[model samples]
Target: MTFTAARVIGALMMAGLGWFVSDLVRPLMPESTIFGWFNHVNLGLGFLIGWAMLGPKAGGGLMISLANGLTAAFALATVGLFTQAINEMLRLSTRKMYPNPLRALEDIFRILADYGSVLLHPTVIGPLIIGSVVIAIIVEIANSLWR
Candidate 1:
């Protein structure tokens, strides 16, 4: 893939976003042993999303950049949450919690729905929107400076 200042900055910003999101969700998680790689997964996913989505739109106007930034943020949140849900579903399935594969799959959605509501809280969404705006501004500036 092509390397650019925008990509580097975007990736770093989103990586931080992932870390922050993980921290926000920590208190919400039920008291249980968390998977060792949970935070790492979110970091890596956020980096990739930023590189692919936010980075490419860096040179755009403020509104366009904000639009893309918001889209990227939404994608990061949705995909990260979905990954966590799948992990939970797999954990349950391994313990023989589900009667069949279809049931296990359905649990993924149920888990997502449960966490989805929590994500809607003002505390969570406010930071997310603010972060996206900051990222968009910084990335746009980087694009102008570099190219």
Candidate 2:
């Protein structure tokens, strides 16, 4: 398959897998469980697997793998940010705090800021960095082998 086609399929498969895994684990785990962090790493893994599937002939190397991992991480973060924004907006609206779109947008920014602060904490950053590196290495190896 073409590289673009592979990437599309990989993204869809990864999204489905991520949704499935999140659903399966959510009910079984406590709110404080480390497994909560897995959602962020899922996107990186998906990118790695997708890129690796394209084989060495695709001309991607370590740099590309790292870039893809970063993209995945950012994508996951964006999704989380939007989800948080929607939930926060609903809660605020019910509390009569969001009477206008401007207020709602303000709440979204606040929510994003809160998440940004939390992301700086070691517990979150550590896993994200490690997971991205591991994903890059694995994808690099796979690409080399396929060459």
Candidate 3:
């Protein structure tokens, strides 16, 4: 389905705000606390924010919201992965001689592989799926009632 301008803007805002908030709070919180469900919460917040801004005007009902939320989650994860890769690269560079392009690429891939495992962990995936489903149901009901 197509995303309206308002829905797109809302989703971007949600993702940006979520990332900003998560980054701000991540350092203050324990790693154990932020490891699994942080992305899920950010995604849920994205969907809620988008829905709140666009309401019935966004169209496509629950499915759209679910799709958008998942998209936002993936986006967040990708950004996190890249950020991790960059940080790792910089840290390594500081210790070693300058890395060639190939070495840098390899380092990024390695970091991505490591982060991928974390992303796919049951604790992370389970909560994200459950949360998205619950949010979708609630959005469906709200949209139905509003119409």
* TM-score for each candidate, following the candidate numbering: 0.94, 0.55, 0.52
How would you encode candidate 2's per-residue C-alpha lDDT over 12-80 as one tens digit per residue? 554444444344434444475444345655545544454444223223766776676565545554655
The digit string of per-residue lDDT tens for model 3 on 28-135 reads 444654244555566556655554543344346767767755654565556656765666666667788455767876787886776666656655555544444444
Which numbered prediction scores highest in TM-score against the true structure? 1
RMSD of 2: 6.6
lDDT of 3 at 142: 55
Every model's Cα RMSD, please? 1.3, 6.6, 7.1
Pairs that collide, model 3: none
Query: Which 10-residue window in model 1 sums to the lowest lDDT?
Result: 27-36
lDDT-based ranking:
1, 3, 2
Better of 1 and 2 by TM-score: 1
Q: Measured by TM-score, how close is model 3 to the native structure? A: 0.52
Clash number for model 2? Answer: 0
* lDDT, candidate 1, 30-125, per-residue tens: 778575688789889889887888888787788888888789879988998899899989988999999999999999999999878777777776
